[model samples]
Target chain A: MANIETSLKEAMTIDGAIGVALVDYTSGLTLGTLGGGTTMDMNIAAAGNTDVVRAKLRTLEMLGFSDGIEDILITLDSQYHLIRLLAGSQGLFLYLSLSKSRANLGLARHQLRKIEAELEI
Target chain B: MTSGSDPYQSVRDELAALRQQLTGVRGCVIAGVDGLLILHDSITGFEPHDVAALSAGAYGISRTTGSVLGQGAFSEVTIRSKDGYLAVYAVGELALLAVIGDSGSNIARLHLEARPVTQRLAEKLAIETSHPFG
Candidate 1:
């Protein structure tokens, strides 16, 4: 299994990736992060996005659906933010932000799924 | 101390269990982020209150550093002195777990053993007072 650092580093190699982080939605803590340079703050984004995850889960509970979220997509004017809930780890997720101009949405999603599969923590 | 019906017994039990799992553990304390002591299993000479307060200070600084540097939320902080180590772990959003270990202690192993305990302690200490009458 890929360790947290390696998983995060691998995530950064995805096309048009601006930043990535592995966050604990329960406490809004990032286990590891990469990219998100001067223009974007990966850490802040990681913590802030926990609310989004929580809200979605709450909605699922309210609806009494036994289903799981595949991923969340947020399209900004110039960026695409993706949040993928990792399996086998409760309250954990992988967050990726991509440059809209450079990213292929379908491929990014596929790459993230592959990375999540190998992630150990 | 009474075992059953004691609201804090589970906290006490967790501290004791941690000591059993890891060697060179001089002491352990659970404190609120505001610096109030929740419970502790410490040696005679150790000062838990002061340690709790200092731990709170350390947590505050470390969390701020993460935020300012855009690194993310504070996970834990470890300070190694020549004689021993002081490690502080965040317990959910409400409390901190501080461990004092001897010089021979393995830092990485301590982390592996202690992290899950913090999660359990958070669950035990969580006050379900949302509806006192319910």
Candidate 2:
């Protein structure tokens, strides 16, 4: 039953977590956000990531498969962007932006999962 | 709205049924290629419309990557998170089925259950488009 604000704060605590948001993949909207400043805009990041999610879903339909999205990861030169869909919550997702230099991919994924489990909405 | 005469009725019905079959899954949504919701079953706190849009966006990116790599087409895509996973499967050429769940969920089982539903929907769409009475 943890609120989104709590979740966002917890996500920031992860080593190297630069910013995080609970984004609506459908509308490309940031439902909640924390961290990220100056050079990074959580809203823009969420909107741009919408394309990433849409592209993967489209490719699957063209190929004629039956399945659903689990999570999406984009690795940049100096950063890592993670888009994780909320299980049982249709259009909600957690958009995590982390610095590659300081973030542990494995641990970040683990923490995201934990946060998802505890996330109330 | 034409009752039995509506060509998309059967297909829509099938999708609804598929939604039920996937009831145990977390954050699952059935949406059209345009990202419009066809059917969805999510936890109380989730928003189906938002997920559908994200699914559409993800599908779009995947298509571009496929073209760039010279891949023929994509059937499915999975993104693994630290604590869970997001999976999107194609149901015919115009629809997508997305699921978000814990890493511990039986992905193999989910895929198996969704396969027949996808195939059936594809066939139904093909028949409707090809037959006048369908």
Candidate 3:
């Protein structure tokens, strides 16, 4: 039961957070973003990642797969890119990036799941 | 080699070859940025005009998003469903390559295969657009 900015702030509290964005996949727009304004282009990341989510959903639909995506994890050389589509909110998603060396992967995922549940919009 | 007087022949041939090579591919279309159908070789039951319109709309949004964020140009955009994938690749400035492929398709491989064909089509379209009478 938290607003977008509050939810984003809570997300950054997780260990080794680089950035986080709340994006609308339908229009490829950022609802809110935090922690990377200094160095990261949050809007661009949000917009581009919409394709990633759209691609997965479209792929899943074509495969005739019934299950929905929980989250998508892309492991880069030094970072982990996590895309979590909201179960309750259609066309909305949370995108988070983490430093691989400092973040506990399992714990971060668990925390993200909790935050998603509590997110109001 | 001399070019065909019919401008669309090579594009059609390339599309047909793509369908044959990619076992999982269902259909494809090359459309202008304005959502106009330039050439299409989709299977029966699939509507290319609808796809052309949708792809153009999606691509337009992506490009606008990119510009607002200062990310420059977007090379491609992909959409997936339960049974397959749909992707649109930027072909020069005139057209886009939109494809529909099944779940079993190796997507990265598909992109690799599609790139060269996209380049050729782009070049041809660039020529045709610049010299519509010649």
DockQ of predictions, in order shown: 0.02, 0.02, 0.03
Please list the C-alpha lDDT of all candidates, in the order they appear: 0.85, 0.75, 0.84
lDDT of 1 by residue, B26-126 (tens): 99988889988777895558788998998999999999999999999888999888888899999988799999988756455577678898888777667
Q: On residues A1-121, what C-alpha lDDT tens digit does candidate 3 reach at each position?
A: 9988889999999999999999887656678989875777777678677778878988999999989899999999999989998996587889999999989999999999999999986
Model 3 lDDT at residue A8: 94
**Cα deviation of B33, candidate 3, in Å:** 0.7
Judge the docking of candidate 3 as incorrect, acceptable, medium or high.
incorrect
Q: Candidate 2 versus the native: TM-score?
A: 0.47
Candidate 1 per-residue C-alpha lDDT over A1-121 given as tens digits, one digit per residue, 9 for 90 to 100: 8999999899899999999999987556688889999998776787678768878888999999989998999999999999999997587999999999999999999999999999885
Which of candidates 2 and 3 is the stronger one according to lDDT?
Answer: 3
Rank the candidate models, highest lDDT first. 1, 3, 2
Residue pairs in steric clash, candidate 1?
none
